[model samples]
Target: MSDDRRTTVPVWTLATADVKAPGLPAGESMTGERLAELRGVLAVMADEPIVTLEAHPLPDRIDRGRGIPLDAASPLAQHLSQFITQSARTSLTAARATASGECLYRMVVPAKVAAQLGQGTVRSMVSKAGAGGVLSPLVGPSGKIAAHASYVPVGRAAAVGTVGGAGATAGAAAAGGTALTVAAPLVLMAVAVGVSAYADQQRRQAIEHITELLEQLQEDKLDDERSALNGCRAAIDKATAILLDQGRLGVSLGLDSAVHTIDTALSKVEIRLGRWRSALDGIPEDAAVELATLTKAFPGIDDQGGAFRVHLELAALAVALKRRVVVLQAVEHAQSDPGNPFENFTRQLKRDQQWLDELELGVAAVLVRLSAVKLARPSGLRPVFTPSEVDRLMNAAHRIHQLGVGVTVDGRPTDVAIEIARDKDGSVTVFPALPA
Candidate 1:
């Protein structure tokens, strides 16, 4: 609102008509990238370089008026609006943040600055080595902030402007930089020496701790999860055994009892695992990070091992259950449909039910893991995941692969093109969005 009243101090919009941003969110319409493109176009048309606001006190929220895209709407429209509004509010807060004593500040300069710099129309703000701050750009009557202006903290205005003037060229920079290069190697050498001295000591301590934990897991609590996992495997074995056994109804009843017994054991394991869910959350970020290198590589995805582990266990159970369906279908298909056809049909019905149950459980597990991955983790910490986490995901991925499901979308633009749904025939339908 304060920005609205300043007729002489108007902020520029991105000012591009055909801004091409596929795969970018609508809320990012006035983002710095788009703004830069705007400045380039404006400069080409106006026959002069655009200007940036060098003399910024703080930008209270820049109130770019809002309107929806001409072609589309999405389920996240409300959320997108909320985020854009929040960004405006946040920018405003950042603009005036110094007054509030907020220590951290970020300033996104207007796009015009880039256009000027790209075209060599203006010189950049220079900084003297060891200077405390930077200089602000000068404002001109042309309604542009300054030709070669830059964003600097309100505190750094003096140091940056005076640091290196027109006389300081790349040649001068070379003459002044030997100390920094030498200093960096020396610092690195010292760090290496320190790490070498401490590396063995840390290793010994960790080895001792891990040894103790292994002993405990093997003895005291004995992680019934080991048993649970075994039980799940045993259940699959029993289910497969009975279905494959060349036994009549009377003979198979004993095998069916074994299946029920295995199921009970697996259920106990599931309940036991539920108690350990919180411990997964307690896994140190450092530890989870170490483990993530083994799972997958993606960006901005959170350390999901905590939730993903549970999903893995459930997925394993579902997979084990699903394997029984394959055996059932094989056995039922082996039987002739004409002779005792009703009995054969009943077997098929039972197999279908088992398949559906497994499919539902598996899908739910995958979705849960997907949700976990969606949570906030330290961004770009490392691309590699830890071996254990990777092993877990690989196992889950293997099950999903066996199921052979994938994301799909269909529909006209006038109808819902992207929707998430599950079909009874054991496939997931995902209607993903595409740029218009």
Candidate 2:
């Protein structure tokens, strides 16, 4: 019966169905989408509003030799439909979980409410609660589940009416009197009941199909998010180890007051650099800029002369450096090309990881100073922490480093590192060779 007929599926944004079929008016077929969407209208008319949902193959529209349309519906759809009865609306469990770590409140009170709920419905109840952000912005790098499950509400109805008609005009019958009229009405009633039951089943099945679709979209979005999170954590780990090896964090945070104290010292250095620039401006030189750099990038750096390019190379090594620190080291390229030596193709993404080790200590120090995550330094402050005190400071570093030996510093692996001796006074030295 659906042969050569175009099947139209409406989109979500539209409240009214606009399905256009030629035999009917432009909006006439819309009734099929929502004769108050057929589900609602039927519920209202029938004393019992039973609906059964089932998943079945879509009727394929086969092409004849001519137009895209005008072909028979797919035989598969018809076959599947014939097999299914009113078994589509079976209930599923209410409990659900979202893998994405997205929260439950967001769904309970969705971020955006659509037109299906009228303006009055908003005023009716939900409007009293104010809106809020979906995900907690404070959620750290750790993974946690944050979603809640939900279910759909539905109504049920009863199946009534005789298998066939009971009454008929007996006087107008054939030679057998009541027989001819009696049989005709009975057949009509049989057809009506069967058609009614089938239509009800179809409506229920369609709703269930929609629900499954919504769940799938949510799962796919979660998968993409989880993958991105793993990438970030990997990047952090790689960069942090490189910085730790170069001692950037140590140089940066080795002196408690010294680290925070650098800001005022840095400002003074900048002022002196300006004075030197003015003095050099009048003198002509082959490389005034390089000469000037030698005089004043900063007192810690400039007066202690070194190359900027060298700084860049050291920066690469101190990948675990949570902040900038001065150091010198040689870099060997595994595969050398004409490309920049400071940048390795494999290690580009992990650059910022070095910064965490540096700032974390600084932050902890400030917090202990200001009372934050945790930190402890000597009450007695001088030029810097005494050497003995600094050695004891390593205790604050993870009791067990996350690197755990599989990590490398300058191609030296540390899957297993042993402590040869400890200066019982207060120092621990680990000698990790190429670990097996």
CA lDDT, every prediction? 0.28, 0.22
* Per-prediction CA RMSD (Å): 30.1, 32.8
Report model 2's TM-score to 2 decimal places: 0.14
Candidate 1 residues 141-200, lDDT tens each? 232322222222111011111111111111110122110001111111111111111222
Of the candidates shown, which would achieve the greatest lDDT relative to the real structure? 1
- Stretches of candidate 1 off by over 4 Å are 1-245, 249-254, 265-311, 325-436
Worst 10 residues of 1 by lDDT: 177-186
Where does the lowest 10-residue lDDT sum fall in candidate 2?
11-20
For each candidate, give its TM-score against the true structure: 0.24, 0.14
lDDT of 2 by residue, 367-396 (tens): 222111122344444768778666544432
